[model samples]
Target: METLKGKTAVVTGSSRSIGRGIAERLAARGALVAVHYATNATAAQDVVEAIGKAGGRAFAFGTELGHEGDAERFWAEFDVQRRAFSDDGDTGVDILVNNAAVALRDHFQDATVADFDRMVAVNIRAPFFIVQHALDRLRDGGRVINISSAVTRLGLPEVIAYGATKGALDSFSRILAKELGSRGITVNVVAPGYVDTDSNADWLRHDKDAWEETAAKSVFGRVGEPEDIGDAVAFLASDAGRWITGQHIDASGGTRM
Candidate 1:
């Protein structure tokens, strides 16, 4: 049942939300998960504790992404923990999930330079360098999965800047898949539609009419859950998904159908 019995995984921005879901799902499959957080150390630790109670293995690491030298600091801390987790030589990352991102409600007309720059930093730039830095550590036959958004696929101009970054991420992932294929490393992207996360609680959970409207967007008659995306990632990170590199998987549960 433990498909990833001895594998190691690092999920960025995993202190909560979709990242938390991915970390938990990976741990469920017997991977030793490194729960990476930006600033919420307590939240990250809570995830670790919860995983422990569930009979899974995990640890917490903190580093603010999208800043100078963040990728270097991140992997250094990861190596330290990987050493403590086992005696074998650090094999780098078996699974790397880039799930951290900054989203602001800005349209093309409203998006400021600050908004564009911040989103680009965390959503695109951080993952760009993080993976660049991880290449050395990412073991052969490893998996690199990037979390994306439905905005890129849909004409959601409400978040022009945010959507642009995700589009770039899609391009970045596909190219990596091609390049890393020779080394047996798989790179892919997952684009999620309106999920039921804390981030959407206000409109999707509290507003009755808004909840109905969002649910109607999905043919499933319900909104996607964080676990839905997590399970999808788990499959792609598994041995069964090795042959599926450089692909964009729509995990939106038939959104806008």
Candidate 2:
């Protein structure tokens, strides 16, 4: 079950919520994890400490993946973290979980140029380059899991921009799977629907009746938890998923028709 033992993982935007959940899961499975945060060192450090307390190895890394120079900074920081922690260089990465993303509430007509640009930068640009940078470090039988959203298939109107970016990523992941399949590298997308994270839980409590009504639509009868998606991502990043590639699997409690 320790398919990820002695492996290295870089989980971006991992200081909180789903990213943090994914990082913790990977570490628990015996992988050394690099936790990347945009600006909150304290939160990232907290996550690192939590992982350590649970008998896992983890380190905090900072990067503003939404900006121009952030990508280079991310890799440079990662190299330092990896080398300092893995002196023998035998702990090179075999798993890359693209979990970092930005989301803003905006209607299509009201979304500004800056809004669109920023989302694209973090959601699309960052993952693209991060994967490129980590390619050399990834072993032949590596795994690349992109965190996508149900909005791509749901086509929610207010989330046009966000959904578009995820759609593009879905396309990118499929093509990448084809390109890297020969090298034993697998690329896949995991799309989750309406996960009950900190923010959503608060909002849902305020509208209990509405939330219940919405939950009734799904066969699962409840919103998703971070652990739900984390488990799915871990499965894909494991040897059990070696034959799966170039596919977008919905982890949505069967909500979409």
Candidate 3:
């Protein structure tokens, strides 16, 4: 349970939903979490407050991760906070969850270069460079969990660009695991299917019949929650998953054929 004791984790896009769930889970298991958000300062602060209230250590951070030198700037601010608070002066992160992503749900023909570029920037480019910037700080035997989508396997319509980006992430997870295994660093992907987050709340509420139709595909007979994905991430980040790497675990309850 204390497998992550004395560790520091950074969860990107953690202001709400899946990212928030992952951050909470890591903090609950004894890791000091940095809740990173692109915007929404109040929401990010709320997350930090909630974690603190729950007897966990956490901090709120903000960054426009897709711009030049943004990663370094973000780290500098993060370091100041860590030095001001952490008992040990180590800003080194032991867990990196690349959960920040932007989804573009459009048919292939409807997808524009702008949409594709945005997807690449947030989901693919940012994660790759974030890992690069954190490599030296990521202690050996650390964990990196990439959040991917099951749409890549299911080939969901109207999500071509989003699916493509997730596929790139999944591939990145496999390749990075092989490259980092020698250093005892573990890299894996948690691919989730149709989680009921704020963005999807409208659909689940107004489109009840359609939601049920989609839910029937899963053996669980219901949609997943952010916590469902979070639990899987916590397991992979724990000693319980030391032997697991170079793989993509579909947290999708038998939704894909």
Q: Give the root-mean-square deviation of each candidate in angstroms.
A: 1.2, 1.6, 1.3
Q: What global local distance difference test value does model 2 have?
A: 0.86
Which residue pairs show collisions in model 1?
A: none
Q: Lowest-scoring 10 consecutive residues by lDDT in candidate 2?
A: 84-93
Residue by residue across 1-257, what tens digits does model 2's lDDT show?
56689778888888998898899988888888899898999999999999999999998888888887776788888888777766875536788888888887789889989989988999988898888877777889989999999899887988899899999999999989988899899999999887777657666757888688768757889877788888898898888999999999898888755
Q: What's the lDDT for all of these models? A: 0.90, 0.86, 0.89
Q: Using TM-score as the measure, name the better of candidate 1 and candidate 2.
A: 1
Any idea what lDDT model 1 has? 0.90
Off by over 4 Å in 2: 89-91
TM-score of 2: 0.94
lDDT for position 256 in model 3: 51
lDDT for 23 (candidate 3): 93
- Residue-wise lDDT of candidate 1 within 67-121, one digit each (tens)? 8898898888877876776778764679999999998888888889988988999
